[model samples]
Target chain A: MDRLLFGDNQFFGVNHMSEEKARAQSMKFQDLSAVIDVLDAAYDEGIHTFMCTTHDRVGEIVDYMRTKPERYAEQIFYPGMPYAHKYANAMTEDGMVGAIKRFLPDGGLLDAAFKGGMSVAKKDIEGITTLLIDAEMKMFQGLPTPVIFLQNVVVDLLLGLGFKDAFRIFAEHVRKKYNAEPGFISMNLPTLLKVLKEVGVENPVVCSNINKVGFRMSGGGVTAYEKALNEYEFQAIAMSVFASGAIPPREAIEWVCKLPNLKSIVFGASSRSNIHSTKVLVDEYWVG
Target chain B: MIRIGMVGLGKMGLSHYSMVNAHPDVEVVAVCDSSAYLLGLLNRYTGVETFNDMSKMLAQSNLDAVIISTPSVLHAQMVKTALEAGVNVFCEKPFSLNPSTSRDLTELARSKKLVTQVGYHYRFVGAFKEVKRLLDSGAIGKVSHILAEAYGPVVLKPKGSTWRSKKSEGGGSLYDYAAHPIDLVNWYLGVPSEVRGTILGQVFSRETDDEVFSTMVWPDETTAQLSVSWSDPSQRKMSTKITVFGSNGRITADRQECQTFLTDATAAPEGYVEGWNVRYTTDLTDEVYFYVRGEEYSAQLDAFVKRIESGEIEGQNSFGSATGADEVLAMMVADANRDYAGIAAGPAPQVDRGLFRRRTKS
Candidate 1:
């Protein structure tokens, strides 16, 4: 993990605070080249890690990156799995079996299918969980995926359902299978960390809403998040640092960077200046 | 009695087991399921031997035939194993996950001279059977086009965890629900020579498709459209209907009844008249010895038993027909997988010059 990792919310049109802005961002990034151009700008500025959702269009970006290997030699992809919409769309069109066939690794079809069956029949949650992770990670094969994330949609749902063991299952599978650190993104960071610890996952890397003014921070707000960061040993990745454009760049970064044990900040920016200025603020404030 | 061994005691398997048990000519000698709970329940109640493995059931039970209700992915292997054991087989629909494996199973069954059937019970539904009869009798004249739809509310939300929603386990509406209509089209109009305009969409389930739309052209040039969805909330549970259009009239049929409309008196069945006519499935369907879901299930089982007893390996719902349908489905899936731009780039239809000339003359 670096001091700043480029987020994909802007490229994918996911603005939490404003639906109008989200729609505008979606229209702007309909063309893949526009997304690549912005990514190129960020890359040129020495920001290489792209923590993105496993959207279908992201496959195109991954393919594009493959073509220009030397240019993206140091690039890292942190793919969040079970892209709910992609799977939903694929399942609606291809059917469960057909969609699995479409996404299963080229040569591991039988193995994956067998694991899927075992997962279903034996209640092998580990098998099913790992199989899904494998399916989600299929497109990122041969790429630098040092960290794979469980998307917040599922993370929070599992949290609500009290399926805490799933966190450990995901961690074990990600470590054993992809040899990558399993990261979790959630709306409630304190609860997730507590559950992750209960499941025997120590010092886990978690990303959550950790901005100034308590925008969307559900579990005890900014004070509790700061206390958890200072007291807990887990590595923290701060997201929603700008509080959906509510907080000023300098104030938000300065506030978040000064927080103890804040290992990195993930931010989305469509323009070079936004990316560069955000990076500059983090560099200036992050004394460690 | 023809001794039968049942495998995969899931919903379909249990239904088939009771039907087979009720048949005087068929005896369910043993059952197999991966679930020990289901196997134990069957063992305690039925007094029939049970096994957790299909091969053990096949080997231990002195079976003349095997009924496979396993998931689609296991169909080929189970059917292959039973056929190689010289036992007749009645497997469930979509016979195999893919075409090549389906072809292999069909070829193996043919070589062994086994009485094999695929559980496409819709083929035995009286209304659909009547539809087939009317089509074959030319009551609707030369068939020009057909529309087959199968809709159900099995998956209306994100169900990526279930085997029915997972692609690896043969989940998705395409393999699960659409096969019925695709098979019906194959039975009504011979194998399709070409397929185009496929749209596989997802409504709810994240891992597999809940909706499938595709078009096929048969050898005789008659076209058919297939639309299947498992996510439509308004649909009845597993409702399958088909409409056929011909030069003279059109016929429509579902699980309940078959209806036909004819312009000419000459193009009607024996009891049917020119205008519109309807026949309820209860009237047309044969009396089943045991009924679970519908008479079609018993009818299909009886048909399979008769085929096995009489050594008639080829028929309406035999493995041969199933393989033919599987081949068509595989072709449709492959075509659907092809670059959509190719189909999207098709030329616009040309104007009818003869119609214009006739208008000008008039």
Candidate 2:
């Protein structure tokens, strides 16, 4: 994994610290070209992996990147699955059946429906999980997706609900079917790590909140996270290192870079200068 | 041990069920919802009892407490049934559409000596709770003005109607969106005595308001302005922000952090200094056993369980307090439709309706 992975939160109007900034960026990136410009700028900075949610707009990015093969050959996507809002809108707009029909991968629509439908009918976690994974992966067919993530919404839900077997099922499918590493994003690092280890997912790639002030860190906050980092064998990706811009840039970067087992740092920025500066901070302060 | 039954398997319901089901002292014995698929999923996964009917669950599950997350229209009946069955209740917000129903339910809960809590989860948010602490501790002096605001992208375009757009079912933006901040204001400065300058504007939905703007006056003449809208595409999700202006200091807080400006540190709470001080959510929040969207979500349900164990009849966000907020909402809705002649101090010029007049068909 690259030391720095760019994220898509800023382009999608997600600013944890301030809504005004989120709205401004959202409006600025309304044009697809603006989004591409930022991605290209990240690429120029040598931050190639774009860890992004599978929002519908991202399909446009995949298409645009696929067109310019040699120009973006090194860049890759780390797509997160089952963007809840997309499915939510679909569910409300067109009920359950319509949602499944709309999001299933192309071709053999009836066959796909029968398989996915039977999963829904039987309430099989693995069936629905793979079906949705295939659906989310459809847009990134030819893209280099070395890592696929289960978003925290469902991950923590499953963790708290004590369905630890789902982790094993997800990891097996991602490895056997897609030949990619299965990643889990969660807010509760302590609980999620315990579950992952119990499920025999050794040396897993897990992304979570890791910062000095413990912003958004759950399951014992900063101390528990530090313990996990020091004791655990898994590779950890640190997100929200700046605490959504609440912490000073230098302090945030410095604190996170000193952590152990830190495989990558994912962040989002709206400008070329911000991206360059953060990249510079990681380069200067990285201790491991 | 407290045995509980979960009602309504929607978003909030499912979230609360997950949190409370994992509590060390609480057991989610049965799950109730209209969808058989959800019930089957829960029953199959966890080997818990499942019910399609609320009363049957309340009776057969032998529940000591019931957590209700149904629609606001159904909250009144579900809450009353749970209370009548001698079960402690934790319900989602906007306790009931009708203020009278809320009042009667409050009475019923009190009469039964049952623990009752309404899911105004914002009250459990660490920053918001710190704001409450500041005001109560006199760190902000006496608040004379407040600005409470909420915005979300629930309805940005002309969209088909959902339960949220129907005033009777979900109470539109006024009840669904604005209730959070309004409950905070009510928590801070009781219910307002006078409500005027109300505007129930419709941006997209024709059946109900998409935005609610009103100014409320407390008995002490402390004024608060409420500006809320669900049509703002800028906000990716729902955000509730509250600012209190006091004689000696001020406080502004949302889900992220709390900012307090004090003139003097002499009376300020410990760990806070004079001038501007900011407290991040991570610093203020206590770790929960089961973390979901936010710590507040789990904290609220944990609070309910603690209340049941401690025999606490009065909840910080009890049906009684939600009734206070509901009364204010009732006043705002009424004021929007009321017609009153302004008291003109001097001669006013007569004006034609012009473009302001409704276009009548020929």
Candidate 3:
């Protein structure tokens, strides 16, 4: 696993804690060129993995990167699937299948299956799930996507709804079709880890909020997270390491280093200085 | 374990469903929604139970409590029905479309001593809570004026209108979005006694106002400038902020952090200097056992469940306080609907509009 992963939240105006900062970022990154410049900056800083939600703008980033392979030879994209807003707009006009059909790489088979039999409708979930994954993966066709994630919104929802098998389905399908590791992004790590272990996905890769203060950590907060990280046999990728800029960088990084079994830290930086500084912080503090 | 039934499967409904379903002390026995697909999907996945109608779910589910996350139009009816069924209710914001109905529901809940709550989740937010604490603790003395503002990207262009754009349903930006900031103001400072110069301005939606601006006047002459806009693309999502100016110092807070300026060292709280002090939401917030979108979401649900178990009819976001917010909203509605000439808008005892203060020759 990459020790330093770049995230797209800053470009997408998704500061979890501060609206003012989010608005400022939205204004700063309205142009695609600004986004590309930052990505190039991160790449120069030796952070190659870009973990991003499959927002429409990401397609443009993928296309831009595809044009110059040599320039971004080592750069990798970790795509998170099922951007809800992308589906929402289309769902309002056409039904779910119609929305899926618009994005499905090979809609003909799914369309015929839906028309030919009612069986898929009854258990349309797995069928639709694979199709949506294909649809989202289409944008990253030739790119190296080593890991793919189910967004926390859907993963947490599925977790709450008690469909433990969905994790297995997501894992198996991703492994079989995309040749990538299936990762789950959730707010509740302990509960999700238990479910993944039950579903037989050993050493699963889980990304969540890992910080000193219990900002968004759920399922028994900081102490429970400490217990899980120490005991569980899983790769933990810490996001929101600074708790959305609430905690100072040195303090946040120092605290996160104390946790056991941490595989990586993903963060978003809008400037070259920020990227450089964060990389330095991680290197300086992660000696343990 | 508390046997709870969920109604509605919209965006908020789905979130509430997840939190409640995962809660250890609660069992989501049945769900109700108008969407066949959502209901079918939940039934297939969880196999709890599903209903297309609220009354049917209330009758058959044998629920200890029902969480109503439907549109504002349905809250009054569903809350009334749930109360009559002898189950606690957690209704979404803008408790009722009409102020009178808000009053009646509060009265009915009080009479039955049923645990009731409104979904003003902002009350559970840490930064906003700190704002309330600072005010209640007399850290900021004799607040004279306040500026409450909310902006969001709900309506960026003149496009299709959802239920939120329909004024008749009390689903306009005023009720759906602006009510959040207004609730914050009401929570910090009591509900204003007078609403003046209320302007329900429209920027995008033709069916309803996309922006709401009003001046809220308290009984003691403290005033707040309420400004809100849902047609702002600059904001990625809904951002509510408040700025208060008092005799001693000033205070400003949003969902993320609270900043305070103290003129004198005497007014400063512990670990705070007299100049400027900031408390981030991360430090201010407490951990929730089941975290979703935000801890506040789970915290509110936790509070509601605890109240129900403790048999406390009044707690955070009680129907009584919600009614206060609704009364202020009703005042804004009336002020916006009324056509005002300059003379008539003049404060009593009716000053003539033509009179002007003498000005020096420029």
Lowest summed lDDT over 10 consecutive residues: which window, candidate 1 chain B?
B37-46
- Candidate 3, B325: how far from true, in Å? 1.7
Q: Model 1 residue A247 lDDT?
A: 80
The predicted structure with the larger DockQ, 2 or 3, is 3
Instruction: Please estimate how well model 3 matches the true structure, expressed as its whole-model Cα lDDT.
Output: 0.85
lDDT of 3 by residue, B10-91 (tens): 7777789888888989999999987666666667666879889989999999999999988788899899999999999998
Model 3 Cα shift for residue B233 (angstroms): 1.2
Where does model 1 exceed 4 Å of error? Answer: A1-288, B342-362
**What DockQ do you compute for every candidate structure?**
0.01, 0.34, 0.44
Q: Among the candidates, what TM-score does chain A have in each? A: 0.89, 0.91, 0.92
State which docking tier applies to candidate 2. acceptable
Regions more than 4 Å wrong, model 3? A84-122, A246-248, A284-288, B342-362
TM-score of the second chain for every model:
0.92, 0.93, 0.94
Q: Pick the candidate with the highest DockQ.
A: 3
Q: After superposition, how far is residue B12 of candidate 2 from its true place, in Å?
A: 1.3
Tens digit per residue, CA lDDT, model 3, A1-288: 889999999998787666677878988999999999999999999999999999989999999999999999999988997786666545332444566777777777666556543233534667867877887888899789989999897888778878777888789889999899999899999999998998899787899999887778888888899999989998899999898777899999989987888999999999999999999998998885
lDDT of 2 at B53: 94
Q: Tell me the RMSD of model 3 versus the true structure.
A: 4.3
lDDT winner, 1 or 2: 2
For candidate 2, the TM-score is: 0.87
Lowest lDDT 10-residue stretch of candidate 3 chain A: A114-123
